[model samples]
Target chain A: MTVATSDRAPAPAAPDGASRPTPRAPRRRPRRGTVARYAVLCLMVVLLAGPLLWQLSLSLKGAGDTLYERPPRLIPTDPTLTNFTDVLDRVPVLRYVGNSALVALMAVVGNIVGATLAGYALARLRFRGRGIATGVFVAALLVPIETVIVSQFLVVRSLGLTDTLLGVVLPGAVAALNVLLMRNAFAGLPDELEEAAVIDGANAWQRFLRICVPQVTGVITVVAIFAFVGAWNDFLWPLIVLSSEESYTLTVGLNRLRGTFYDDPRLIAAGTVIALIPIITFFVLLQRFFFRGLESGGIKG
Target chain B: MSSSTDLAVRERAAAPRRPRAAGARATHRWRFVPWLMLLPGLAVVITFIVLPFGNTLRLAFTDATLLRPGRWVGLENFERLLGDDRFLTALLNSSLYVVCVVPFMMLLPLVLATLVSRPGRLMGFFRTSIYMPVVMSSVVVGLIWTSMLDRRGLVNETLATFGAIAEPVPFLTDRWLLLFSAMFVTVWMGLGYYMVIYLAALANIDGTLYDAAAMDGAGVVRTFLSVTMPGVRSTMALIGVLSSVAAFRVFGEVYVLTGGTGGVGGRNLTMTMLIQREGTGLQAQTGYAGAISLVMFVVLGALLVVQLWLQQREGRTR
Candidate 1:
């Protein structure tokens, strides 16, 4: 695939001897353009991240502090974690975090295992109805979850999984996007790798497990993060299925906080921050893999 | 060089391999492996997606409720939908939202992607920062923007400070403003997500194309139109369809922003919101909700078909 070549090829080619000597000066006016580009980028960042930063500032403010002060403060003058403490005191913050963690963990495991297996089969193996299976998945990608939510809820209820973390986790367990992404990743691998294994008397499963799956670690990581973040951030489905407080994920829990702490914007902000931290942390830590995976999975697929 | 060498090795290996008998035997034996691998996933999809989807179609004809089994009354629910004022408002609102959001979601991201497509030290940070909102939950985004759009919120405060308005605008309370505000937030949240996709598409365009364009004395707009635009056209079309579908099905953001009441006079009520209200609200019109979902499905299905046709045409021409 072009993605495989573009992702890997450009980095090493940049330092060619012919192009290295005059890097600072080509036909372009480099200094002015660079400054303008940086200026535009900085403005874009501020505009994009400003509200989130404001949310952070709000979370840090004292409860009595008005958010609508004449000139809004980007920084809290009297910074405190009282809102955080208040949110914890008012609600089962730890319990909600635990529930979110469990759901996201289950979703991550389920997506990685399910998507990998199915994707590997779709991409590499010849089987009955392979074309139909691929077609079903591609079609499923277009079916918005919201459109099917009511019947999905009924189906979950029929299965007796309502108000449970499993109810929240089950429907999202095998995202079609992840399956397709994994399939693309597998398809991009050099056929030689698998053929080499096959010629050595490796079974189909053995070749897939040892040789194929290992090569797509990048895509796997991407799928895991997407699944994790998706589960963590999901609101509507979890809201519909999980009715009780104990079973509520962080998103649901935070929504409840909005009702309970409606008068206290600071506490709500604190709850928002709590809900945001984990996925943001995941994104920050795996930022490289996340972007690379998105590039390959998104464009090629 | 290594790929050629590997091809040679593969050819040599295949040439020395056993004849058709063993190959046929192996193929027969391995035929079930793919099915085995696919079973669990297919089971999930069938149970959660396929079954529910079929059931939704079934439920739409009946008067289903949470507490009661449906009694099929064919076309009644759809007929009711035709006269349901809330359903009509929702349809109009949803269409308006799609019209407002889809173009911005498409064009803004393309512009941003082009601007930041070049690699540099800080480009990574810029890309990530812009993308940060996309990674956050819709609930959190809703919360953040809800507060920001408050009468005493930062948005109005900034505007007032600049003397742009005489009074605080009712962003969340006023119907048109609320829709616009929601659209703005949706675009903001989506900018980086779509930009990343565009950037990836941009990476595939050979840099030498730009060099060639420059050699022909094409200015910025000319080069972009001739080279960059054509290069990302398929991706743009894909994003257009995806974003429109998303717009048509918008719920969480509006739900959170309006605190789940569909805002004043149901002015900003989207079709998904109507479905949620019907299925789960006090009246519990589950069958009606199903009918609405079917309508949405039809709309989305039509879009998908158009997109596929466009893609096919693009392929054939190429």
Candidate 2:
């Protein structure tokens, strides 16, 4: 969701030095405001979460259930996992899941290893041309994926890797944003620990691995989550790169279900639920890190 | 909102100014270790991102295809685009998308941020539930809305049941409605994401201002207009720039909603969709697609430039 125009606009950076007589008055608000706020929040929840839950309900509905009820029943008439199994029987969703997992795994590992090494290099191990390397990455941040997406496909095709999972992973393996993000993390670290290690005859690699990497695991986790979510949820690049049915990721494959089961909304709903479950589970488990990164402006969409 | 973090990273990138580097950075190290570390990262970025961008530009000028590398046909692709109705529709659709969608994005998210900014246990649940849509894939988001907006889908059925409409609206089948429906989806998925950004900016505003406003006997609306608006003025502008840029580049919503046909008569294509439609396949017109991509990139860049110009002017005024 973030573009590389990295500078956010002005924030109120005033000093909190006013010695006012009212020393932090009790935080209370009018009842009318609270009531109106809750009313709005409830509407928002219904608007945002309603569609997802509706899909879930539709997916769980039995074959005998009516989908086009005028008021649209919130609960399934006969909840069952038949739609999920039917989706599996109709489409090779497990295979697509495997494809998505492979792409995401490669992206995660590649970003963690590649970004960490380069970030440590840029931040700690000073050398010539460092500025140029950093500039190259900063420039990469400004190039929107939409612009380079087709050219990237052309590049992959030229390499004879089109329609392959590796092709899907190649363009995103070490995203420049993650590299720069990792670099920022390393640069923020205090030099006291690493300096002592350097004096004690530890090499650059050791300093990076034993000391620097562990400390920035917070950012590493952020990178990993973003990479996984991005790789899993990405629709456009994979849609372009992989043409064969066998190479389809979950996202690209789910669209195929629409053509195959256009008449059966239940089946399509089941496919979407299947596509959503893993990411939803991921958010449920790692929501702390996700929200933490979000609030601190660490993760990109 | 994450852009603020980049402000810090940019400061660090300025080099020699960061005091934390004074110690270990000087002690340095092995001769080739740094380059060796950078080799993989730099290689991947240049090969995949940077160099491909150059190729996209180069291909924009040539009559290239997937099979054979054709001769350079300078300006032919762009020139043809002047007469290309698909190109024009795409440009208009994307431009109109930015215009229609950005206002909602600017207002809804800020209101959401203000509501959820208060402290309570339920606030956490509200925030997370609202944000759930942001993490869902565009494929899923599109499917959800597509089903909901189907002729017999929930939205139409409910509208009919409530006597709001005598017939089902052609949300997916009609070109104009498809574009508008896609914009709605864009704003829906993006609402929580921007609200979180605004939450951070709202946090930065001093609590004392609200207190002072209350002490001045101002009502809720008065306090909001005077204190809250000015406090998040720059954030509103930033969201304006971000949302417009994202809206202009929109692909997934319209693509998936129309099931990749670009709606009825293929009149609903966004810029990125146009690029994809023209750029892919064995007989794909790489040149024309590249031209579309170039135009989209230039527009996005212009959006950011306008934002920066506005920020600078606001800074001057302040």
Candidate 3:
């Protein structure tokens, strides 16, 4: 799966002198740069897309086609979408999608509300215990989610939220990293605006919503996309929390495609591709925002 | 302006007296504002993340098996770890992975960012194409690569056609190849992410630096070395830390690639895998897994501190 760090490439900048063919080319190129660039690009295509394409081929192939006598064809000879239909029929695919969507939505909302409020306070308010809260968060970064799984499970179960969408979403609604990112974004905004709003009889909430929130829409977009991707692609927590088959998310559901459609690799690949399509689109759409967010974050933070 | 100045003077005049009289009331009322706003997040962090971490630490110290009550074993778990060959192997494998992947991931992104930063007409397309894999989950990546590395997969088929080898290379089964394959997949997955990070840093770099360098007739490579590289030094350090952390935590690819065995003869069992295997593998030795995890946590902590120190030093030097 795509790691979070990679998805946040800096947005392309508007080039100065868009038409200038500067004389710097000869200085940089040793002939190998071109060769190396092509080589890397070719390698990138192969390495990045190879598995995805292979999965597609295998998924479409008929039974016993995995080790085809002829070298594996890129496309299936029969070219059937049967695997997709088969996966749809064999298991509770819709239910799994619903569960994943519900959990992810809740996670997004929860993270936004919790992280935004915390970020605002940390950014604007001067209060006691701020230092301690910040320290707690930074410390939380070192604590692997896996290390706390059992404890979280216990706590969720005790709270009666376990095995439900709320259970899985609530625990992860806020994270230290999100807080840090949001704080960075908020800190960059001019403080004068908030003070002006306060002077104009705007309450704290109003000023934050109208003034601070708009100023940091870029960061908010980044956070929302991150939460969505994280919740959607999440595996371990969902695996632990959602015991019922009906509560399965896409990641778990796709994994089930392996056993249910045992002989059919097409079904699995189709399932993977289907799952990946949305995620890839999401990344592309937000690529511009994600890059800007990271770039500003690095400098200001 | 006079009114504002008067108010400021009044506030300045009143500041000393108000602190003694209104300080108690103001402090009490304002103190809760930040805390109140922060409570919800704090609750989640403590309940889910923090408590769970504590549980892991506690669990590590006890002789607990799955579904069994743990007995306090103090340093025994830590003591047993000193002799854990598998732990040692996983540690070595993870180190090797970090060592190899970090430089490649770091440099490739720097290069790719440079290339795409000013990509003439194809900038958007090239950037998007490069970043396509940045959104997919690791599960999908693992599944995809497994399909490719299969015996009759594309790489081998191409090799066979070119007569590059007498036989198809067993990519997943062979130990070194398996590691390489996993590393390759990891780097591919990682490149676009860091590329974006670097791209962002590059955007912030004052274009005038390049202009200045060019005015001085400095070569592209020289400008890059003297200007761009130094300009993005802090960002590079940040990425280095992040990349190292990721490398040290290598698990998912190995788990999916070799199905948690780390390929033939446990050649690829990373510490995370070892801990996971002990916890849920056929053995299900939670205590031992917890112990392995504790060792790993220490390793991670030590490595992170050292990395931070190195970066701080580099920052100062720059």
Among the numbered candidates, top lDDT falls to 2
Stretches of model 1 off by over 4 angstroms after superposition: A1-35, A63-66, A299-301, B1-32, B212-226, B281-283
Task: Give DockQ per model, in order.
Answer: 0.37, 0.36, 0.34
Model 2 agreement with the true structure over B1-318: per-residue lDDT tens digits:
112112233335455367533222332334566789999999999999899899989989998887767779999988999999988999999999999999999988988888777544466778888888888899989998999999989899899989999989999998788888999999999998888888888988988998888778777788778888889998899889988988998988999999989977779988999888889878788877888889988998898788779879988987
lDDT of candidate 3 over B234-259, digit per residue (tens): 77877877788788888777777785
Residue lDDT tens for model 3, A116-211: 889987876555566898888878866766555555665676687756888878878997788877777777887556655655556556667888
Model-by-model lDDT, in order?
0.79, 0.83, 0.70
Q: All candidates: CA RMSD in angstroms?
A: 6.1, 7.7, 6.0
Write model 1 residue lDDT over B78-185, tens digit each, in one string: 899889888899999889888999998888888788777755434566788888887888888999888888887888998988889888999999988888888888
Ranked candidates, highest lDDT first: 2, 1, 3
Q: What is the TM-score of chain B in candidate 3?
A: 0.83
Better of 2 and 3 by DockQ: 2
Q: What is the DockQ of candidate 2?
A: 0.36
- The residue pairs found clashing in candidate 1 are none
Better model by lDDT: candidate 1 vs candidate 3: 1
Provide the TM-score for each candidate, comma-separated.
0.89, 0.90, 0.84
| Residue lDDT tens for model 2, A1-301 | 0111112111211134332333222334454555676678888899988888888998999977887877779888789999999999989999999999999999999999999999988887666688999999988888888988888888898899989999999888898889888998999998666656654556667678898899999999998998899899899989988899999999999887888999988899999998888999999888877777777666352
